[model samples]
Target: MPTQAHINMPAEPVRQTGMLRPALTVFVGLSIVTGLLYPGVVTGIARTLFPHQAAGSLIVQNGRTIGSELIGQPFSDPKYFWGRLSATAPMPYYGAASVGSNLGPANPALTDAAKARIDALRAADPDNQAPVPVDLVTASGSGLDPQISPAAARYQAARVARVRGLPVERVESLIAANTEAPALGVLGEPGVNVLKLNLALDAAK
Candidate 1:
């Protein structure tokens, strides 16, 4: 019988070691670039180019931070314009806990909620005969919308005017002045920033 030939085989440990080194190097490199460098660069650019937005678009008054233009504040007083209903909890317009009510259109809970809102509005301004705007009763998708439809704002104009003892025309004028046109003239319907409108109303007083 012929003598058997011997062959060498690479160990499994050696192959694994070869693969692990490059993978670790790649992971470290990518982590530094994406996790550190990329965010730093983007934040720097945002601070430089859009400082107000980068700073949360805060609105200051009397040397104090009152609110942010990007977020809605709860204004239940009849003298102020109301923004969209917030579903956030444990309070409305709670930015850190922003969320929707998640009730579908056909859900009975949603219908009941709408009915309650309508009843509240009717109770608040029993003399006003105009129909309540739907947006006034519905919580927005994000539940933190700081703006309301122009129609919604106008619907409450008479109530605000009566509550503040201001003329209806003056309140309507404020609404007109605060109303923002659609972006690029066609992208969105007109809306009024409730915070700004309420601030203007205060300033007017």
Candidate 2:
């Protein structure tokens, strides 16, 4: 019943060999180059050239790890110098979840948050009449900034000194000592590292 031309055609055999070998070779070669060799070489170079930074720049005291010098911690206590307000939720200064409020100047949320910070600062030191630094009232973009503007540090010096029963001059001195200059002497504003200043206070005590 079938035509002779149709019946005469036979099924072509499935060819699996020729293409597979080269495909596997390419996959293995690329995997080795991208997954193993590249990471190993880069890690080796970083560890050799920058040992301390590669190890995370952690601060250890009395054989116990405190924290990293690179990340900020929440310090709401009046005695400790506070760092930038983090947008992280459930916890502040969570490096794993760095964020920003992303609120514009015209946003009511931003205004309210700034007011809250200002009120908190005022409540902490009612007697001192110095104007609150803008840095103190607003969160930095990263929300994990370890440093505050020198003015912000000076603004809180009085309350910290009072609460700790130390002279304000001493607290200011600690702030001055812990202050860091802009990177490469020109990249950013000079900032006072809050954690270092607070730790120096503890050491002084």
Candidate 3:
């Protein structure tokens, strides 16, 4: 015969079964809403609202992908206009490793790198004595800026014109044409898309 208290008391009082089902249900619901539904809706909205940007702002020419407008490229040829300096390790303009030199203005390493860039530019075009643009000698904050300041583009115009055997006026006109105005007329400074301009240069007859 069992005791009166044991007979009256509930079985498995210490087991956590009470919370197990509710917790599982809540977990499944939250996972569905957050992990699946939320991302799906956001992606759909982005694809619908901004297809170009949603597609990575890719620059396609002749059914081939040249690059993305969102990333910088290394252009060392004197015939092409170089964009801002990239401090990415292992390679210049390495997409996966976008990073600035993290050096202050007075840092000796920074100064040496800037001097090297200046020397390279001078060596490429010995006769051009114009002061180089600051953007050309310095890397942008992200080290992945696809566009260069308008002044930077203009600074390199003569060198590109001379090497390409194109008229300087023509090159300047190209620069003017490629110069992108500030977004919404106020969001950012005017910049020239270096890759597009170089592509145009190649396409010209």
> Judged by lDDT, which candidate is best?
1
- The residue ranges of model 1 lying beyond 4 angstroms of the native Cα positions read 1-9
lDDT against the true structure, per candidate, is 0.91, 0.86, 0.90
Task: Highest TM-score: give the candidate number.
Answer: 1
Query: lDDT by residue for model 2 over 96-128, one digit each (tens)?
Result: 878888999999999998899888888888997
What TM-score would every model get versus the actual structure? 0.91, 0.84, 0.87
- Runs in model 2 with CA error above 4 Å? 1-27
Ranking by lDDT: 1, 3, 2
Evaluate residue 177 in candidate 2 and report its C-alpha lDDT on the 0 to 100 scale.
Answer: 95
Clashes of 1: 0
Task: Give the worst 10-residue stretch by lDDT in candidate 1.
Answer: 76-85
Q: How many residue pairs clash per model? A: 0, 0, 0
Model 3: per-residue Cα lDDT over 1-205, one tens digit each: 9667645656575456877879999999999999999999999999999999999999998899999888989999898998888999788888888898899988999899889999999999898799898999999878899999888988888899888899989999999999999999999999999998999899865
What TM-score should be assigned to candidate 2? 0.84
lDDT of 1 by residue, 17-63 (tens): 99999999999999999999999999999999999999999999989
Kindly indicate the candidate among 2 and 3 with the higher lDDT. 3
